[model samples]
Target: MNKLKRRSDMLSKRNVIIPLIALASLMCCFQLARDLVDVEKNLDYCVTQAGKTLAQINRDSVFPRDIEKDGKRWNFVRKEEWTSGFWPGILWYLYEYTGDAKWKIQADRFTGYLNPLTRRPAVDHDLGFQVFCSFGNGYRLSHDPGYKKAILRSADTLATLFNPKVGTILSWPFMIKKEKWPHNTIADNMMNLELLFWASKNGGSKSLYDIAVKHAETTMKNHFRADYSAYHVVLYDAASGKKIRGITYQGYSDESMWARGQAWTIYGYTVTYRETRDSRFLDFAQKLADVYIKRLPADLIPFWDFDDPEHGLKDASAAAITASALIELSTFVPDRTKAAQYFKLAGQMISELSSRHYQSRDSNSAFLLHTTGNKPANSGLDCSITYADYYYLESLIRLKRLAVNQTIYDYLR
Candidate 1:
């Protein structure tokens, strides 16, 4: 009789536990559904705002780079500018999101202004920024033969800057004369390697791929400190190809972790790993990402310099870049727990960025605000920069795709 009573008690407990588990799972599915709906709504808002901004800038015949401190006037630049590609890239992202013909039209128009770059000599490492972001996305979406030609030519131009001895591309040609840097390569240069990697596989010289891999490997060996935090610039001996020193041009100090520089490292290595299938770059990317994640403020947005939290200024651009990288990085991670963690953190960043706290909304035509561009030089401080908007839209697209079990690279196909 006692055994029967105990069995009945156990069965009763099991019945209650089963229903609770089912209820919890149902709630989780409901929350996920709600989150996806919110993502779509946010994307709708971004597309509308981007259209308005594009219309405003269309009258000027120049790419919009950032808003002034007053937030009334825009800072526009010519196609030769490093930031010129982001405006078109933003349009490309919008077109990808909505499959709208109007965005493709605008993207094509703006991207055309950069065709001259294909024929010109390498001005700096920014050929990738000035060309790839514009024509690369253009080619990806429309598969235009002209765009492919331009990309290949631009990749060849970019390769001109890579010194075989240094095993990395020279970042600032003008800086060599002005700053006395014999061979300076900055963390920002990592983002440009994609153009070479893509070009090599797509009918360009195989040397393009070799240059990119060497650059990644060289940067990995010299750009980082023991903690995996990257320096803004690493000076190499031009003749010997030896690292001279790691220094800072944009961070608060030579030792400080520059938010954008670290963000670039995370995004760049993620791309490198994707392109090369290199486990080393993948591991390095995760380490860099982990350090950045560990040092983030409570809001998930990093300060312009990780060491200067008391400055109280946030780099929304850095957060946006990291968020986009993290989402894509999550897809490549083999461990499910780590992948989920990365995805969740990326979602949190997107949520924070989409909130009124970061969105430019009524302040300006730009998507997000409070980016600290070249804070050390006092340029573009606390402003709405173009790349911030570009990556924010990108993160949203990545998140939306992943929510549907699709990879962010699905668009490449």
Candidate 2:
């Protein structure tokens, strides 16, 4: 009789536990559905604001770069400027989101301004920034033959800066004389490698792929310290490829972690891993990302420098860039627990950035504010930068795609 009673009680408990589990799962699904709806709404808002910024900048017939805080005016740049591609890249993203013809028209026009860059000599490492962000996205969306040709040409030109002995591309030819860096490679150069990687597979030389891998390997070796916090600049011996010193040109100090520079490594190594599927890059990227996440403030946004004593200034651009990279990195990591953590962190960052605290809203036409371009030089501090807007939209798109079980690489061929 006691056994029968115990069996009955056990069955009852199982019944109750199963229902509770089902309810919890149902609630999780409901929350995810709501979050995805919010993502769509936020993307819609972005489309509206980006359209307004486009109209305002179109009047000046130039690409939007950053805002002048003193006058609260937009700063426009010509096509040759390093930042010129982000404006068109934003337009391309908007068109991809809305499938609207107007954005495509403007994106095409703005991207065409960069065609001249294909014929010019490789001025610096920024050719990837100037050509790939604009023409690369254009090719992805439209598959335009002209865009492909330009990307191939620009990739070849960018290769000219690579010295085989240094195992990395020279970041600033101009800075060599001005700063006495025999061969300098910055963390920012990691971003330019994507153009070379894409070009290598799409009608360009295979040497481009090798160059990119070599640069990434070299940067991974020399740019990061024991804690995986990256230095902004690492000077190398041009002839022997020896790392002379790692210093900071833009951070608060030589040893402090620059927010954007570290963000670039997170994003850059994520891309390198994706392109090569190398476990070394993947593991390194996770380490870099983990340190950045562990050190971020409660809101998931970072100060201009992680080691800054004051922590007075926040950088929305760095937050946006990190969020975008984290979302993509989450997809690549093999461990489910780590992946969930990364995705959750990225979602938190997106939530914070979407709030009025970061969004420009009525204050400016730019998507987000409080980006620090160069705090050391006292330039573009607390400003709305074009790259901030570009990457914020990108993160939104990536988040939305992930909600639908789509990968961030869905758009890429």
* RMSD values, in order shown: 10.7, 10.4
Q: lDDT per residue, candidate 1, 35-87, as tens digits?
A: 73377777888887887787677553489999965586578888888899999
Q: Give the TM-score of candidate 2.
A: 0.91
Candidate 1: pairs in clash: none
- Per-candidate Cα lDDT values, in order, are 0.84, 0.84
TM-score of each: 0.90, 0.91
Write candidate 2's Cα lDDT for 133-196 as tens digits: 8999899889999999999999999999999999999999988889777899999999999999
Count of clashing residue pairs in every prediction: 0, 0
**lDDT over C-alpha atoms for residue 237 of model 1:** 93
